[model samples]
Target: MGNTYRRVLLKLSGEALMGDLSYGIDPAVVDAICAEIKDVVNTGVEVAVVVGGGNIFRGIKGAAAGMDRATADYIGMIATVMNAMTLQDSLERKGVQTRVLTAIEMQEVAEPYIRRRAIRHLEKGRVVIFGAGSGNPFFTTDTTAALRAAEISAEVVFKATKVDGIYDADPKVNPDARRFQTLTYSYALEKDLRVMDGTAIALCKDNNIPIMVFNLAVEGNIRRALMGEPIGTLVGGSCGIS
Candidate 1:
């Protein structure tokens, strides 16, 4: 397959980094993912990544458990930063040029998030990893991905998840759930498909950035998605649900 998009934002859930473990990142898994990223970079596609902190912590869950909402979110943001560092290290070890840019401004560990700098890094063939969730408490890494994708003029958002694509219902719970090859933003929002947070989906819709949700668990899926191999569901624009 040929590369259909020049630049793309990859959204990875932290839980995917856990691999077969119950918590924390798996070294082998991170290395494997970095290898895929290396392949994608070698193909001349500019890639920016936004990783979630769900494996380490969930802000909403913490808030529900009696922590202050803002504080919980801030904690979650830090977790994302940790994940970003781990990913950056793994990529660098694979001999792939990578940079970890954080919203929280921890200069000693990472560079602060700057739109121009990030785009420049991409132009220089460096993978830019955005961390710390917009540097705000209420927002999620998903929103960060959408915002960064727009600012960087990315062609699409590759949402890497455990499942292969968007389903009419939870596939794990319902064996008969149907997967959609393509879907409209309005339909997803109207049906509450949960492909992404409403805010994140709205941002992508407003910016006309198509989102491709695919399973990260499958080998070579990242490279396939980036190369437009049609491995998952495409959402946004006039693509009708199926």
Candidate 2:
């Protein structure tokens, strides 16, 4: 039928923008993702995106290397801002109006995050990309996605990752691991599936927001997910594992 969601929050890992590169963004990959988003926007679905910065710098890894944990996390947040700007540029090139709002203040580059302003932009049919990971230490972009989704009253969170779906175990390590078509939020949390950080999952669970975890590398997957094509794992529906 028509699109399955009216407004949705998309969570994109920085590594997904890297393509086959070892580090940094791949222009081609960004363009492809932007094109997919543009198509979805044309369908009248309001879109907001939260991007991670693992490709450029990972706060946890930095902290492990002896850097100040909070400082490392702040750097990571800045990295996410870079990613957000790149996404904005790509989306705009494709004729989709885009706005970048950062949790951290960086007026020279982007507007500081304002909940009302972001919601207004979405209402006006503009793609709003949230950057800077909530402007706090130790919080993940996934959590930011859940928080923003709740703030904007989004129907679902689209978590675009490298894997196609969530499996009982790491699919790469266990070939026999089964992928669940649907899962309860409690199961996901109890199993520690890492569909998202526990905080993010709990936030979504509390808000009763569904999360669709799908492969970002596959072209048209975003559109497929929006159309409710069952392309990946679905979390927080029916209150049980399936």
Look at candidate 1 and give me any clashing residue pairs.
none
Look at candidate 1 and tell me the lDDT of residue 11: 97
Q: What is the lDDT of residue 33 in candidate 2?
A: 94
Quantify all predictions' global Cα lDDT against the true fold: 0.94, 0.94
| Local accuracy of candidate 1 as per-residue lDDT tens digits, 19-48 | 999999999998999999999999899999
Q: Candidate 1's error at 17, in angstroms?
A: 0.5
Residue 65 of model 1: what lDDT?
100
Tens-digit lDDT string for candidate 2 (30-87): 9999999999999999999999999899999999999999999999999999999999
